[model samples]
Target: MNYPLIVFRGLNLLVVLLCASLALGAGKPLTDFSLEELMAMEVTTQAKTPQRLSQTPAAVFVITADDIRRSGAVTIPDVLRMVPGMHVAHIDGNKWAVSARGFNGRFANKLLVLIDGRSVYTPTFSGVYWDIQDTLMEDIERIEVIRGPGGSLWGANAVNGIVNIITKSARDTQGGLATARAGNLERGSGALRYGGKTGDNFYWRGFVKYFDRTRHHGLPGETAEGDWDSLRGGFRSDWYPAAGEQFTLQGEAHQTRAGALRTEPLFTAPFARLNDEPTETDGGFLLARRSWETDDSTRYRLQAYVDHFQRRRNLLDEDERRTTLDLDFQHEFAPNALLDITWGLGYRVSRDAIDSGQVITYRPSKKTDHLLSAFAQAELPLVAERLTLYAGAKAEHFESVGLEVQPSLRLLWTPSTRHSLWLSASRAVRTPSRTEEDALIVLSVRPFDPPLPLTSAGNTNIATEKVTAFELGYRGLLNDRVSLDLATFFNFYDDLRNFEGVPAAFVLPPPLPPLDALFTTRNSETKARSHGLEAALSWQAHERLRLMGAYSYILLHVEPRLGEEDFDFSEEKTPRHQASLRAWLDLPHNLELNTWLRYVDALERGPVPSYLELDTKLAWAVRDNLSFALVGRNLLDSRHQEFPVESFLKNSVTEVRRQIFAEAIWKF
Candidate 1:
């Protein structure tokens, strides 16, 4: 890739577009809110309580609905690129590797994700299945992202960060909406939605969506085999039975079919072969929540959810089914003028059944796991509006892990309304996943003279990975038109997962040769530390033009315990530097143009070179209820590889290609 040439062209194009957009006549401002309103936005993910962005004592970022509309992003992962210090990469058309700070891969386990207060993080893999986590983009109200530990409030697995996707309520979406989209890459996609009110206090909404994406191009003349398609439908109902009280019930179901070219290892003559097979996934979840506020300003909430999913993969000959039930309750109240308290209790149970395959098997084919947790946090007004302190801790218990405690302390100094500084220290943990405890996987088979088969066996005694993090942050309205947020953090990790070599036992079967090499998972004395800095700036350059920029830098170090060897490539998995700039312009006659340019540093381990990319969107509002758009993505390069093939799956390497799409949205 010609980095200089690509960057120069990208800048030139940006300038040309900006000049053209400015030359046109200006209409009404496209933004409904001013920059001040944006700066004062409220976020709930950081502390699980609504607070102004400037007052949140954490590294937080919110992706507003308007931001998403102008981003030209068709997927949730793509929209996350705007967040500083976040890494989003595509392994194929249907798979994404998303992480915060570092340690990024197919199954990056350090981050926690939630959808409308429901936990979407899978205990089976300790990561999110990005492929099937989807919804109507237009229905999302906002995405609140906390770029640090949330374990003190959210419990276990909130090691590095948390992402909470909040959708608009049925009352807010009352009406009818339809959208259709098509492109060379997207192929075809559409959505239909309707909302109504049964009475003054009750509202309901339902929606259905479907999309199909064509396969990506491979290394030269080849075509990657990861075409994807999905159909999903869901409904939401909200009832305000009385003042200061509300009830919400929602559910969704989805069916997905995706293809992958995987390398399958065998014990026979042909040790390995490329297998192109389709994977089928079906899943659904039902969630209910009730919240009420008392006359004295006390608030209480109770929520429950049930989730079930099944996956079948022909390449691996694997079939798995899992179901989870969770219930939670929380209360918030201020006992005095100087103190406020929030606490919660939660319980979850998960059951899973797995069918063995040729390359993978589990010691226990069926199992159940239980989790019990309680957390509390106190907010103290040490110096009234100038200085405040927050302290919290959570205690969680699992049958295998016994008891675990996570704690956090934070201090916020506002000094003034426009500028605020904060500091935090927190401890978080990533519990062992089912795969690390019971599964046996055949890693590779080298058809040597004796057919050496390398296998990895799970250990039941593996310990949870732990991290202690310290963070300092500042948020300031540099001026009326510009706002800036800066954050830095240092993290120390202990008892990280590692692979230890085991003495191989020779096995000679009639149809296969002798097997020799073996390894086992362990929470070895492996330790690591990381430090990073992130900065974001937003400038309302003009009434019709808005610009945003972000940059991030990270460095990680890892070492093995004394007399022990470590093979984990924790430090080289993520890029050390990343930056992005975006511009949104509203032009004459209800026309809008938006562009995003970004650069990502190379990954030492993926051996993937650095790359620069650009995405642009142009839309025209034909009427108050209808609009059309043309979007171009990856315009800077024809195609580029964002990540390497995953080790476990050995999925085919697919490059992201330039794509152009057209969309139409109508509201009634």
Candidate 2:
């Protein structure tokens, strides 16, 4: 069954359009909210400018800081499973292979990631090395995930999706705190943080964290045990020198040690893998922005930022450095029905050195990319505040891809104060990976009955991946105490590259003999679509007790054309159904109780086995400025796997059993 998102999108659009067109002609007029209210929408453009996810035309979800704190989960990937259409694979204690829609693996290349506007994808593998991205979980302000192309606003590598992690401002976390964690699986973890106000407008904070974990001890056979350790430290500072201008500085340094296994075809020998791989990384970002509320009716922002980061992976035996400088300015003349204009340009210089025996180089290679882009979006209130439409397009020029244009159109309507509807369509493109365009790998030739063709290494010709997406959503305040949010989306992809086998024969002579097959990069000429529905509800049952739950249903489809018909690859690792429940109950005294339950369905087949994870926390105010917390995760001792999946060893890997920890927090 071809579950193309477009088919559903088309139907949704027609219905929305017809309803909107008719409502505008026959319904009562609408009320225009204040700019403050419009901006109340969460800013979730994922690396784009600050805009509410509801107002943005793209398909996006925001995992707020409150959500993170309430979940009582340990890692970022664990929180990611809550989002539909995204594939999250917790490969091991210290590693995660995550992507959107599909193409999920240890090094998921198709997804682009940003830490406070700085790109974190590895140039060596064309993806983010999730294991290396570490920071204090408490420091995260919010994480915005977009499940479709964001190429126009964020250049390339966003083929499948994008993830942006935004940290909390120094001013928001002002105090001194210490915490320690230990459990059955998570043997040891600790954190220390301090922050203070430098002046009326300046605030600074610093933190240090260390973590050690025991690997999954599966059902005998000595199949799944590896140890992991990591040490990290970071600091952040924010300054509001004046009323409307702000300066932000943040940096982090970390080192990690983890066990790894090697893969080879030989069956008679034992696996001799690296006992432990140690990696160290350091990075920082500086940003300055000034905003002026010009005359109450007009507002504008001018901003610039610089990012410097470096990383060293033992397996790669090399160090990579990236430095980026960017400048942007935008203005909005508003009142609800007004004009908004935005434009920006950025420059990035990435330099690296490869040590011997590493995949990046026995030698070293360096390349710097330049990018220039301008974008403009306009919103018009047609027929008073009853109907509104927005259209925007981004024109970007990359050093390699030349010029690319991404355009978006959207419409929003509010039939009544309680009901709202929106529809959007957009086009985006993902840039090529550095490895596909530059890396050199040796190919091993093997024979086959069908007789494959062979070709040597070094293919310089590659093109950027592209995607077109459509989305629709509705929001309603069912009652004074209840609210709901619902959305659906679909995306189409082109020029997905995969390795293919070539026939090895008498094609070459001497030192380079022609082999039966070689693995080279080729365009799959494939198309993929993801259609899913996300529904969430929040009910304020009482002044101190609130309940919330969310559910997502997604259907992913992939079709490969232009040869290799037998390779029917569906986007794996993403479940079709995910449901979560959260409840906060306040008992008689000053004590509070929080509970969370998440269910992730298996994708391998019918009546898929879903995993249930439960978390509970009890908080007691110890003093005016201090509190104690008791947290228990996987309370069920759920022997089931958190991310149990096929490993590179042709078997499956399971996560550790249960964990319970006690923590304390202090504010001054």
Candidate 3:
């Protein structure tokens, strides 16, 4: 009855239904020649410059590749569900739990993902494995969600958000390209690309992609074996020898096969079941970057990367391999009209191997880890263009928290150019992985008559899972055809992560005698508090239409720490009110229509109920480089279950049917 008071009465009835739908369109009649071309958009993960998203002071969001081709999404967690305080669940059929603002599960350890600056999380279970994170969503080129706590310029797990992704260079993809798709649960897909130029200063591109999916429905709804498939390829090169120097290189490779159910631990007595495994994965990566600039306020960058991964499952008799090596450096300077600077340095090394049998193990079994980081950010202009100040700090050294420090402070206020205001304070951390410091698990076997074996151990003195955040933002354009964005937050978490159950009872006197029970992993002087509200609105509903909406509300409170009262499902499994609505039309000769509507509120621990979804896309343009489309997704549910029933794969609950697709794109 008290779900954070129904998320504050659904955010006060969504601010009175967004002021009665903007006072019923405030007497429409304003079209200063528009095709909804508002332009002025740029972001760079919060402060690596490229500002303007109404002068970002954080709580960012930018997902464009034409908003992922008009959002009838395909993958990337359904294009991050059009983001607004994200939490995109869908546990099986290629697992995803995606989080932001509140720790949603499936390895969600405070979200931090990147792909142009490479880092796919997963320090062996520190999140992000969204089925191998593919690319070619039309060469990305956007996607910069950064909700809260960026750990003073990205260090540590960036605490609660950060997903960069950025692609599309190589002179913005130049030559031939192709794409094809077919669906009923995406039963086929394809992609191919090529780009070239070598005359004056390099530029090259290459790509290949594939996909297959189908099979989901369980819990009496039949068919569920988690079907999946994958194949990939990639290449890139870009160089420019003059005017601000630049050089780059890229690489990719992939292979996958999936089918899972895997959950075994039985010794008769209705112990455990669900087995049907066949999983394989392979991975690759290579990256290099070099940059220099003398204008645009000075700049510098140098980067390096190499990664490799592998996984195989035979019903929890897993086999895994991982390798990583990374190096990075950054510098930016203004040194003039009121200072603006940035600095960075990082180094990483990871090596892993496991082939353990019988349910899990990692005690040493080959390991190597190292991480070092440094960061700095600064910008101060007391009133040069209407008050601004931002400061940052970061320091990291890992091998189980040997050093850590993260800091931030931000402020921006621009009373004019159509409003803006911002405020922030931050600190973030979440470190400790390798399955929480060296895995080894069992967790159950009790049934009397010689069989008691509950276990769980792996904790090299765990510590570090902290947050401290506060933010407030506002952005308004109110006159150029409406625009508004508001953000609010308050978070404070500490030492979170709990488990400690010890009830010793062991004996092995003469020949043999046995009994066992033990559990450990704690550091929860538990404390959690979360508060939120996010709002977005954009309207240009005239020249060829455009409308956008977003809403989010979240509330979490926890105290525990004294005999931890069952940790109330860690924020009740996400979704404390949510919304998104979108529309875009521009038809007439070169047709295009897009739609998206969503609402979610109800997942109090997957008592999974509330839902409302509708996605659509229809396109046409058979000339300037071909195009055709049709996409429909969950058109009001024919199956649901976004997540729940996954605690070690308890049948990996599934169901997310209803999809339709047909697409084609070509360019030459």
All candidates: CA RMSD (Å): 2.3, 9.1, 24.3
How well does each candidate superpose onto the true structure, as a TM-score? 0.96, 0.81, 0.33
Worst 10 residues of 1 by lDDT: 505-514
lDDT of 3: 0.77
lDDT of 1 by residue, 355-423 (tens): 877677777889999999999999998998999999999999998789999999999999999999999
Candidate closest to the true structure, highest lDDT: 1
What Cα-based lDDT does every candidate model obtain? 0.87, 0.63, 0.77
Kindly list the per-residue Cα lDDT of model 3 for residues 389-508, writing each as its tens digit: 999888989977799999999999988877779999988898877866787665556676666655555688878878899999888687777887889999988887777655444432
lDDT of 2 by residue, 83-179 (tens): 7566675655566768776666665777888877667776656777676676788888888887766665666566667888888889988888777
Model with the higher TM-score, candidate 2 or 3: 2
Q: Which sequence of candidate numbers ranks them by TM-score, best first?
A: 1, 2, 3
TM-score of decoy 3: 0.33
lDDT of 2: 0.63
Candidate 3 local Cα displacement, residue 146, angstroms:
5.1
Query: lDDT of candidate 1 vs native?
Result: 0.87
Would you list the rank order by lDDT, best first? 1, 3, 2
Clash counts per candidate, in order, are: 0, 11, 0
Q: Could you tell me the lDDT of residue 534 within candidate 3?
A: 86
